[model samples]
Target: MTTARLDPDIVARLVGDAVTAPSMHNAQPWKFVFRRADDVMEVHGDAERAMTRADPHHRALHLGCAAALFNLRVSAARHGLRARVHLLPDDSQPWLLATAAIGGVPGEDQELAALHTALRRRHTSRFPFSDEPVPDALLDGLRSAARWEGCRLTVAGDWHLDTLLGLVRDAEHREDIDPLVRAETAAWVSPAHATSGERRDGMPAEVFGPRSSAGSSAVRDFGRDRSMADRGWAVFEERPQLALLGTPTDTRADWLRAGQALERVLLQATADGLATSMTSQPLEWPELRWTARDPLDAMGHVQMVLRLGYGPQGPGTPRRPVADVLEIRD
Candidate 1:
């Protein structure tokens, strides 16, 4: 099969779709470089946006970037192109996370292409979810989505859900007291910066959702430190539905796979008409993160905790321009 060269405009459109993927605090720590001659797009992790205090090891960074890579693949499939992806292509350049050689023909990944409709529709909903449980079939489909990307998605049981909620509360308390951690989080979520349009990344006040009026919620309340006028409080569900995405090994490659799996599950959930949100708050701390996993469960290491139910979709957050993150080489 003859492969046609990918035009720069098409590459830009792909990158545009790629950046829409969710990230840690919406930090968007990924960059794309397209080689016109080779028709390949390189994904790189930007160290400048790294959460030094929270994610010193850059595990969250890898997850966020890999999510974008997954979006790129989906975009390629939707655009009648094939993205041949390689994770960590060059050992020498550790920051270069992955590369996708674009163009081979359409219909190679029809499943991925189908998820394109949900790309922009998926949002991190932090609002209170209804008590209605998600259908088991839908949950199974989400599990399959994760499995396709080389990860496992396990719906948390009652006991595990309670434990996970406690861990999240514990982590919240830690963040409340730790000055450095609070400062780091505060630096990323300023309403003034967002209002001025100076900052293209980070969580704005509008997307923080409401504070829990009663009962503990798995969603991270970003409004804890900042004062937001009229940020109404609502009663969160007593038994919030939660799912854990895990990987067998805890390596850089494993993190990348988990990231891809994370996006896949999220997109599938969105397509199935479920509101979704994720919390890495507990996972940021060593002790809390370790205890988040169930001993008996086959899921080796929990990568992300996801909340799925019926709720208000989160407001769209800002993203850096494609030109800002993408570089084209002749």
Candidate 2:
């Protein structure tokens, strides 16, 4: 870190790491602009890449982009720099979600830098997790991770978890019947590596994991319509470990906060040797979203539901090349 402007190469590297952050359907709806003059990097929500049907309010869009912002901060700290973030800095420019001014000395934030290792190692594990439970200590640490970003992480109890699973089923039924929602999801999913050319984004067929053989799947089945004869099937954990991330208020700023927290929790879980996957099916529907929350808990608006346990870390999903997602300006 120094008073001098950061190098463009370093900025590019930072953005490269940032873009690895997850998005719903792996849409990767984020863009980065590195202003070499000011040593600042800007993160923008890519409306074109947004899941318009599932996320009409762009709540998930903000979450995905903010996850990238969190990654940028982690990258900078790893490289002996500081990323000073300004959330929703420009009201007139709504899509301009955040800007990270880069500068500082070595060891700016050891905690943030520590998460750098998990950046690339962490992938959404759509595969089945063992029935082995996640220890309470690890879960507590994850809660702290979310709290550090001003959000709440509540691990659902048995009854609450069952209720969430029911909501997910309900949401899935609604998605099956709705033409627009189904089309939107299908558009972002690439079958067998890619139905098209070299795809830089979207959940590939290989990562969809084996279809749940049991009565109901705790995870979202992306390939429900596709034949599972080839993909095979497995019985998921009888009681899948679940957690909910939430904010006290539902606003753009709150969504931004929740996104960073979501990534933080995920990275921490990855570093802790836990496989993770995100489920927002219930949160995507307005009517069912509120029910996803625990009435006994104080969490306001639930942002994401996560499954965590020991299992195969799912293969990497495609991310847009840095050159495609990042721009450098003189």
Candidate 3:
């Protein structure tokens, strides 16, 4: 069958939607190269943007890039096209995370296309969530979303939730003493760096949310290193409703799959009128990450800890221009 020609404008639009995906510290560590000849778009992880101190193994980087890849698939489906994706398409080039050959009749992937509306709507909410518990039915749908992406999403039980919360605190304490980790986080969350308006990546002060009034919360505190004017403190939920996203194994391929699963669940939750945020703090520390997995549960390796509840969605952060991240080649 002859492949339909993917116009340059369509490719640009797809990439535009893809970059809206959340990344570690808003690093946006992915690049796309579209080849008109074969109608393929290659997603590559930007090594320079990788967090060497926190993400030494580049697992988080891979996850972020894969999330963008998932967004690309959703964008294609919304546009009445189908994205045939191959993860880690080239072993020789480890940075090449995936390649999507976009071309298909309209209305081919209705389910995926349905998520298109949530692409821009989804944001990482760091503000306080009300005490209202999420309905079991909604949680079940999120679990199914992860399963569709070859991963698992398990709602944390009371015991597991407490354990995970403690781990998050432990991770925060570790970052407090570790100069390198603290520096790395400060670099991303600094107002001076973000206020310049020249750089399009990294977490800005506007989305840092309020400081936890009482104590440590499930949300990652981006303002720990520096103080901001009018950054008032607020009481977070006493018992946060957390969910764990995991895979059967811990490998680059598994990380990529988990990332896609993460985005799927997030988008589904957003579409369902829920505010969501993710914390990889515990997962960043090896000891804490290992303990994060429930030995009795079927979920093997925990990849991310997500907070889902009723709250205000986070403000939109900046993203690199499509011209910077996407390159068109013959």
Candidate 4:
């Protein structure tokens, strides 16, 4: 079968759409290469950007990269092309997480292309949220989004909320003591530099929501270590509406699926006019990770803690230009 060559300009445009995906601390730890000869675009996890101290197993790294892969698929479909993906195609080259061959007409899967608009709009909102409850129907749709990707999304109830909030606090305390974890987070966040002068990757200080004087344990304080004095303070919701994105198994493939589901739910939420933030702190800890799973529900493994509500959307984080991330080869 002849593999039709894709134009380099089209590949770059699709990748620009892909790198908009969210990553932990906005690390943007992924790279893509398009093989014109094979019509395959390979996605790789960049070990240089890996959070060695916090995510030693590369779970978070995988999620972030897979999220980009999901975006690539979405972008392709929206452009009237289809993306056929293969996860971890070469075990010998472990960093080669996935490869997507782009060609053919878009699939009949309407939902896949539906998220195109949300791709550009979804941002991680770290600011305080109003106490308004999300509608059950919207929540259900988010849940179904995860289900479609072979994962589960469980909204925390009153009882579960308290437990999850405490776990976040515990995770924060761990970060405080672990210098390496603190360093990893500090390196990524820059509040002083404007977006124009900023690096291509990492969380800009503007997106780091104001430190809470109210002492909310659920929200993370990115300014704690960096001490951005200019960053103001705000009151996060007393009871934040949170959800757990989980998968039944913990493997490279499951992480990939969770990442896709995560972006899907986030984009859907964005389209619905909701702001979102996420914390994987508890999941970063081996001792606390298992307990993050809902007792009543068999979630298996919780991949991320999502905060959802009405609030100011976070400032858009920086992404490496398509030229930097995607390479073309014969």
Candidate 5:
């Protein structure tokens, strides 16, 4: 079958939607190159944006880029197009994460089209969530979404939830003692007192959420080294509804699959009127990362630890413009 020619304007617009995906510290670590000759948009991981101390192996970087690729699919479907994606198409060049070759108009995938509506709506929620339980049907839908991408979505239950929470706390302690990790986090998180040339990419002071006075750590501690006078305190839910995204393997392709699945779950949760937060805390530490896996489940490798609840949506973070991130090569 011959591939349909893609419109240049459409390529630009689809990439615009893709960059809205969330990344660690809002690093926005992705670059897209559209090859008009063969009709493919290549996604590349920008090593410059990689967090050296926090994510040395670039796993988080791959996840962020793949999430953007997922958004690209949503954008394509919304605009009546289809994207045929191939992960790590070139082994010689490891930085090239995937390539979504533009194809004919999108066919009848109503579910994918539906997620397009949530692409912009989904944001990380750092505020406190109410103790109310999420409906079983909604959680099941999210589980199915992850399963579609060859990953497992396991919801932590009872004692398992406590273990996950303790793991987060342990990760925080590790971050505290490691000066290099603290410095990396501090570099990305802006301080309230910093003079004018502040960055738009990292975690800003306004959305740091409140510091936990009761001693339970949030997924990530944006407030660890900074003191913002305007920030206020609130009580987090006693038991946070947490879920884990895992895959059978830890290959780069697996990371790519897990990343797409992670974004799908988040978007679905957003559409269902739920707020979400993610912590790679345990995943960041090789030793602690394995313990995050549930013994009852056959989840081979945990990719991300997610917190889902009903709470205030996180403030919208910044992104590099489509023009800056996407390039068209005729």
Candidate 6:
């Protein structure tokens, strides 16, 4: 019944909204294939764009792609449609993350639809935030957003925060020593793309924000040693308001759920007028990951470390043209 309505223009627009999702280094490591006959869109993770050293197991990649998946759901709901998803739908094709069968189940997902306004507004802010703490009430709403997506969002206390900060430093030290990791990260931070704006994807120099004069405890310093003119330094907040987004188990499926939950939390934060940034620096290392988790906390495994506060919104990163990542089949 809805097949006739799922035209190329509508599908293209939906995919365009989906690509606005944030990915690691803004790599935009995802692809969407729309099957007109079935009215389903296939989400695939692009191996060539994957951060080989940073995301060895592709866990972060899955989270990034899943974030895009969540945006697709939001777009569908906004258009009075529903996306029935099946994760890892094919055992034969590992990169084929999931497929969303679009059906016009209008009014069923008003909450997801409501997040549509925040889709473009949500950007990963890398600048310093004010010392003003986020309210407990607003934090609670963000927690609910994660819970609705079947994940846990834990606010880091003093001790936990210290541990997390240390881990970030440790990860930074490791990245400094590991040449592979540094090269991989540098590949995505494109200077030419920053000024020329020719490349469709990658984090440009301007979006790298300023250097953290506080020795980069709370945030990942992507500007490390890069002699980019006018990239000044700034002092970050004394105590960052950190949140841990976790899942019951660490698997491809769990990573997918984590991605959806991550975006939901981010979108909710944006809607609530909060500036946000996230770092997987600590979680990227297996040795540092387990230690980063609070032993007493019930969160089985941490999927992401997020910094939330009031601050200057980070400039938007580049994204692949919809034509570059989307394919339509008869």
Quantify all predictions' global Cα lDDT against the true fold. Answer: 0.91, 0.90, 0.91, 0.87, 0.86, 0.90
lDDT tens readout by residue for model 1, 39-113: 889999999999999998999999999999999999999999999999999999999999999987866498899
lDDT of 3 by residue, 1-330 (tens): 445498888999999999999999998999999988888999999998989999999999999999999999999999989899898888899999999888867465789899999999999999999999999999999999999999999988999899999999999999999999988887777575455667788888888899998889999988877768778899999899999999999999999999999999999999999999997899999988989988899988999989999999988888899999999988
Tell me the TM-score of each prediction against the true structure.
0.97, 0.97, 0.97, 0.97, 0.95, 0.97
Model 4, residue 66: distance off in Å is 0.7
Give the per-residue Cα lDDT of candidate 5 at 194: 29
Q: Model 2, 247: alpha-carbon shift in Å?
A: 0.5
Candidate 4 Cα errors over 4 Å, as ranges = 1-3
TM-score of 1: 0.97
* True-structure RMSD for candidate 3: 1.5
lDDT of 4 at 296: 91
Candidate 6 whole-model C-alpha lDDT, 0 to 1:
0.90
- The number of residue pairs in model 1 that clash at the backbone is 0
* Candidate 6 wrongly placed segments (more than 4 Å): 1-4, 192-195
Per-residue lDDT over 168-188 for candidate 5, one digit per residue giving the tens place of the 0 to 100 score: 889888988999988887877
Per-residue lDDT of candidate 6, residues 168-252 (tens digit): 8899899999999999998887765355868778878778778877676577777785887788889988789999999989989
Write down the RMSD of all candidates, one decimal each. 1.7, 1.8, 1.5, 1.3, 2.1, 1.4
Candidate 3 residue-wise lDDT at 203: 84
